[model samples]
Target: MNNAETLDRRALRKAAPVVGITEPGYADHSVEAGILKSIGAEVRLLRWEGKRDKLLDMLPELDVIMIRDLPLLDREAIAALPAGAGIVRYGVGVDNIDLDAARQRGIPVANVPDYGADVEVADHAAALTLALVRRVVSRARQVDNLKWNIAQQEPIYRIAGSTLGLVGFGKIARAYLARMRAFGVDDVLVYDPYVSDDYLAQYHARPASFAEICGKAQIISLHAPATAETRHLVNADTLALMNKRTCLINTSRGGLVDTDALAAALKDDKIFGAALDVLEQEPIGENCPLRGLPNVILTDHTGWYSEASVRSIQEKAALAACEILTTGVPTHWVNRW
Candidate 1:
């Protein structure tokens, strides 16, 4: 075995296990630190600060690595990890990680899929849908600028008796459906080929094609994953099927929608409005066409954030690390080879 692998095994046996975190936005790692400390592990925050080489250099020393969304752990980084070392994602979405490389290296990768953010994301989607349908943000802006009773300038639609469409009927989508149902949304249409018809019937939602949902539903919310089949599911052709009264809300993967098509639709008033918690490119590029659209509402992809959810994800990720260190397996293990 290499010196790094030898050192790691020795550290695991004699010294405290080393767990490193990369590019965390949290104020402190106290929660994760406490969890790892309880298992006799040392927590190190490798805030490489956009320095990829530095992070690569530190990977060899860690028995486990916990990461969020930033500073992607690509193949090179994964290959740098010593044998027996494992990686744990802070939350769902392992697209940023090079899973194939980790699997090839026999380095187990795990993620905390259920960190209790379903409610938060669903609430955010509902909020965005309401804001778009009611012209809430525009009205507030006009009211702040000394405009009175300007609601008539832009038509507002009542939430009751409207059709709700969901791109994916996962946990977040189900939670969003419940919230919309409370708002008097009776006719629900869902387009998820993976789910069975019985599953849709259980929730009182009708299974429909993507075109049908776009053409029929007044409010469409996206809760799909980012995959090759799902990318750009909302493209020009689909946007053409939407009516002027439609409102699109995406709290899921940004790649699910075609930004250019949506922007063009908004520019032409082809749809009512759109609210998004995610974008095709994060920190949204300056050249992005979606910016400066009055009818469009954008958030910093924070739909999965809440104090409780943050704490939950942190604790769960740390526990996964602990499991890797102690049992050589994680609760939500992914990339199994």
Candidate 2:
């Protein structure tokens, strides 16, 4: 090749395209740089917080971004970014990403549904179930205070031979059923009209109407997804069906259970206690009533996070992003094509 042609190619190589990653110093990721290089892309990871100065400087070279609760991808920010830059959300839910706006700009948004979280979530629900049935949280303090009480211990229930009702028959619900089988929970009732009865039977679970499940189970675990139809699946009316000593577990979306209704049910001892891994609003405000309630066991949504899960998440999430950016198709994506 001629020297002039070689110089032109060198210049083009030096001006490699940049891929933006908003979450700087990712916890368990190693694939980002290699993936970027393979596609003739330059990588830039940032912790930008809608800062005008910093964003303006980085905007020109960026052609793709990995969004992790970063700047809103609304019309304004979309207009502000360099033309032809697409976005990829890290996980299953894409509510944070502005899909309509991205679509309008010819920028595709992507999400990975690498759902290893199912088992962990079911385990979390079972943990809550054990905590509630044994009054683990409730009885611990009294013992610590050296006040041995009999009546406080009398209501403690046994999980063995008890009925476990699942409100939804998603992946998590199946995992929960798998685990509950070993717990001596012979009667597993599932409530999801979409799943065929024969399909559920393979999981060792029987189909039950929502009302029947609500009224019968000694332990209830919610595994429904967040949808327009299931905004408040467990409302006051359904909650009222639960016997006084029933235990409720919700590792599913917080909106699945009406918070106010749950608080009322807990206060009234309508259900013996509840074990919730989610709340109506995450990073739940300090003034939230459930936080103060003693009978309830509250965990800050850690059901989807674990050491191994984090590494898997980073790998799968990176793949999902790269897949969409290069191929314009999300392998684990949820929405329309």
Candidate 3:
């Protein structure tokens, strides 16, 4: 063989599989690099600038992709994926990914569902709930502005005898209930249709309709996924059903609540207050009405975040990528062809 042809063959034989990250957010890629190296794969940051061109440019070289918050992987993007490539979402929610498209293309898609973020999210939900009920955030702002003795100005109800409501009975919801129960939340009305009555009874919670939860519970927390059915689950009708003194807490998907409806409710004092760790539009749009609302507290979707949680998710996601690259099978496969 010619010298050039021999060198080309040698290079092809030594090529390593590349695992690209849609957008690199972590301090370093050491964890992903270490895990995927065992399977002869290297990690590459796509550095996707929220543009389709950036994704298309990187798709050809990637054998697997690990995604976090941005860059929605739609059908077009799925079509551009390398043959036999796989996708692994960094966290639980795969709403940003096109699972059906990946399935049709015979590309396996997986998510790290049990990376120990349940505790962090549940704790964050409880913290938001407390801040909402006790007027902690608002009161702190008031105190910062030199306003004191405002207890009666903004009524702070006792949580000891109030009822708690959970929109979903998942691991995070159950953990949140455990925390609220300590604060004397004896009555818990759950609105998850998927959970059985016996299952809820084990947690001393009773199943209730959505309207009943809004009408009866003094504090309602949402923990549902963002599917078509669950999108805007908290809208005008549901918000209208809520007692005026009720507080809403959402640490789950932002799409679960209608931002406009929620803004109107808070403006009219339809509900007592709301503390949100997630928003319909992240980084919050400039025109968002909830921006300066005293009755609303907004956070930048940090409920599922912690130093430990970040590391755990990174490790789990890398392991999933390694598994898929080595065996063509992911641990928590979402798209099973």
- Identify the leading candidate in terms of lDDT: 1
Model 3 agreement with the true structure over 17-50: per-residue lDDT tens digits = 8899876478888898898888788788888777
lDDT of 1 by residue, 1-337 (tens): 3334533554556468789988755877899999999888999989787888888899998888988877688999988897668899887888788888887676888999899979899899988888888888888988999998875677888899999999999999999899998999999999999999998999999999999999999999999888999999999999999999999999988999999999999999999989999988987899999989998999999999999999999889999998888777688989875
TM-score of 2: 0.83
Query: Which of candidates 1 and 2 is the stronger one according to TM-score?
Result: 1
Give all TM-scores, in the order shown. Answer: 0.94, 0.83, 0.94
lDDT of all the models against the reference? 0.88, 0.73, 0.86
Worst lDDT run of 10 residues, candidate 3, spans 1-10
Between 2 and 3, whose lDDT is larger?
3
Cα displacement (angstroms), candidate 3, residue 295, comes to 0.5
* lDDT preference between candidates 1 and 2, better one: 1
**TM-score ranking, high to low:** 3, 1, 2
Write the candidate numbers in order of decreasing lDDT: 1, 3, 2
CA error at residue 31 for candidate 3, angstroms: 0.8
- The C-alpha stretches of model 2 lying farther than 4 A from their native spots are 1-17, 23-31, 48-62, 68-85, 98-101, 149-154
